[model samples]
Target: MKIVNVVKPAIRILPMISKDEFPRMSIEDVQNNYFWGELINNQEGMYNFRKIGMNAPKDSLVLFQFDNIIIASAELLDIEKFVIPKDGKYYGAYRFDINSVKIFEPITLAEINKIDSNITAFSQVKQEINSLFMVEIQDLIKSKQMPILPDELPRQYYGKRTEGAKRQIVVNAYERNYKARQACIEHYGCRCVVCGFDFAKFYGPEFEGKIHVHHVKPLSEINESYEVDPINDLRPVCPNCHLALHSKIDGKVYDIDELKSKIKRLINN
Candidate 1:
């Protein structure tokens, strides 16, 4: 049994626990947005600068699982050795922290082991076992299938109605519904789903929450009882894509995929 070396494009299957023994809510919060504020000593994230002269590689694949089912996926942000009372341990302490993308769908462990049994055979604590993650991720991508919007969009475009339309229906729009928006951010990642543009990466820390959140459907169409489903119903798109999302064709608004293709064609031509 060989523990794989720490390297880029690595994979780790880790489990998370909630005080109540149910981690669904935590998984929801994390999958919907970024998570990285805690530190556990002697785990995958530990103070190793003294031995390696620096923190381990910052980029790797992280999978959060519960009861043998992989619930979410995240990306390694960075590692640091510091003394901060807030973080569980200090002075050469580290924990694998991440900002993630919600899988278009949850994946089962059996399905994963079908790809390679060695992945399930990993004995170390969570955080990168080997390059096996690349295979799983590639398979997941091939099966993504979604990148599409729901069927029932309101015929009415936002902010567009006849001047003398009598009763003006003011739609309750959320440029960002705190919970829903955060989920959208986590699901699509803090990057533009259209062009894959990330503000934080390009503009630095000040632009952390600079990206926009777009509802995949009209606010009016979401009924009183209609709970906003983050995965299928919301998206985190940049301003350009947000504007382009509302672009009209022959009396129809362009969907995200269409706009993406348009951007691609523009870039290609």
Candidate 2:
């Protein structure tokens, strides 16, 4: 006859007196004294700890369990005064909400080792997870659930081999223009400093994009002496207005300050 070994599960531990419970304690105390558990089941899940409150506030309950045993527990008197330690060890003090507290049986060291092995295998397959996310995003765009723009995709995902195709040139030229446009917009508002056209609604098919940033003296004409003066050389102009500013037949270059003053005069008139 063969004998079968049957292990009896341990009983959960519970608190004996309701008055001994406190609100919250420092993270160091929790780590040193309480049993810890992961907030999530996966490796990416947050880790949390549970403990008996020493000065728990009113209407709050503290509960603890270990396998099949009920550990120490308590009820709070003034929950608001509970302050968790701030040394960055544990997630800060949490309120005693019944829904937030979850009790679970403690796992043995052997069980934890098994979990570690599973996590190691999952980490090796990260590329597959990222691919799934990209496919989901593409589906959203095809379904018209997300707006697709030339520059809207994350930079890392824009030109990679995995990305379907590229149509627009993503250059740092726009950065320089953005700096100049912001200055002009801040000084004169979104209204075109020249033609008085508002570009607030410039998106979509109605407008041919927003306003354009122009180099007041035409970047080519600027003597090497002024190459670094962004504020003095840059100004914002709407597409039509920018063309008008360059309409002079004499090919004379205008200073940015002068162009701004000209627009102000037109607006005033």
Candidate 3:
């Protein structure tokens, strides 16, 4: 059952700490904390790195999953980056509207696979929900009448598999984000930062503003999705320079300065 094509906001599947794994807090306890808006205040939402992606912003729907089951839903109210002193590590935390939280009947991954097989893995699902899919999930949650028994669940309930599809999704999202690219070009100009290749000077006015915005921080290194700073994180480069930038030597991708120096040395020789 599909709902009206309303509520087109981004949706994400957030994995929660399972009681079987931690033995400290059960999903029910977490649900109670979330319902009372105490999760963030208590720092229970903090993770080693960002869990939700940049695409998921305020008002985005979140499906809280424990083990393989979608146990609850909430609307993201805000997200913040915090540093933990005990570990001296940066962590991402989320704050969701307690009033919007709905602890629902557990929807297993096997059941969700019937709805959309594209969700092959929990890690693969990430923040890749489309409008139609979002509506379908919204309907699924609304249709559920009761919450699952948190105490009666078995340990090691589900299996996990990793797929390369997530990498492709992140690559596409990083490269195709228009606002980030535009802001990068606006800050750095249309010339290639590595070789100073100007599209307009080479191909005339029609080709003006044509440049590939390269992500300075490789997507492979980013363990989790976090906010990206356009000016600091992106650079305009020609196709050739972009390829050169990606070329690995001794397992190291060349930075702008390293690539530029190599180009200068080659040209002078």
Candidate 4:
């Protein structure tokens, strides 16, 4: 398939975490915040570079590298100096649309170097992404099936909450990480763990991969960011069971086993 762009925009590799003896957020935190709104929009951050300068201009493609792995990519929206009053310093901050960010399973630096020999290593400073590698990167981004966060419960359940507030509750309050959902589905087959409902079976082959992954840990209790162990933390649940899991009974949300028991009680009746 044809992959090269006729007039390619500049591409740059940015180290998400600095190794230059300067303290910064950990790689895990960076990865967690990438999809979460904390790192999106026009937020002041040392995302592109730690120092106060910009090499790539607006609309350039950017690869975010952390611990030698390229975890995410986004188009550079704009670059400006962001001040850190606590550090008494200013650094280059990159702003990008959250919707434009595409996350995938980590691609090692060696894999990237294999595609484009120009990149020998990652740096705290930005490295140019060559044309050959850029094509491969573009292909990878396009081909990956990144899943969206589906409403476990219908939007009507969240009455009176604005669209923006609902989204905030999804990420911050529920702590449902879409990447973790991917990992969860990868480990547990896409059949509902509680009800055994298969989307493909009921809805046809076109819906083969469609499933809502539920966070098993108590969602409302999660107030801070933490690394999710997908197998332990998530399970594949069909929309009906997902809604049941989120439903408040008397005053408490039911766990998986509790939801399963409820289903069984109805089945036996």
lDDT scores for all predictions? 0.52, 0.35, 0.61, 0.64
lDDT of model 2, residue 240: 63
Q: Please write out the lDDT profile of model 3 over residues 1-269, one tens digit for every residue.
A: 88776545677787755643336765554544343224433443333333333446668888877766788787877777665433444355566664456666787777676677777667534545554577788888888735222111111111121111122210122212445656778999999998888999998996888787777766556645555677877788888888778778899878889999998999999
* lDDT tens digits, residue span 54-144, model 1: 2335666666665556665555556555554334423443344422333445566566777766566432246444474587565674474
Per-residue lDDT over 1-269 for candidate 2, one digit per residue giving the tens place of the 0 to 100 score: 99998532111123322223223543222311232222111211222323332332243334332322223222222222225643433333333332232322332324322423322221111111122233332233234222212212222211112222322222111112233345555665555655566666556544533555555555334322222233555455666666656556368644445666876898799
Using Cα atoms with residue i matched to residue i, what is each candidate's TM-score against the true structure? 0.41, 0.26, 0.42, 0.51
In candidate 4, what are the lDDT values of residues 1-269, reduced to their tens digit? 98985555688887654455325755434555444435543342234445556567667888877777787787877776756532544465577655566666677778777778878877777688775566787887666524444333211221122221233322333324455566678899899999999989998996887888777765445544456677887789987788777778899888899888988999999
When 1 and 2 are scored with lDDT, the better candidate is 1
- Residue 124's lDDT within candidate 2 is 12
Is candidate 1 or 3 superior in TM-score?
Answer: 3
After superposing candidate 3 on the true structure, give the runs of residues whose Cα lies further than 4 Å from its correct spot.
1-8, 19-25, 33-55, 83-90, 124-127, 147-269
Residue 46, model 1, lDDT: 37
Clashes of 1: 2
**Candidate of highest TM-score:** 4
Ten-residue stretch with the least lDDT total in model 1: 161-170
As for TM-score, the candidate ahead, 1 or 4, is: 4
Higher-TM-score candidate among 2 and 4?
A: 4
> What pairs collide in candidate 3?
none
| Whole-structure CA lDDT of model 3 | 0.61
Pick out the ten consecutive residues of candidate 2 with the lowest summed lDDT.
122-131
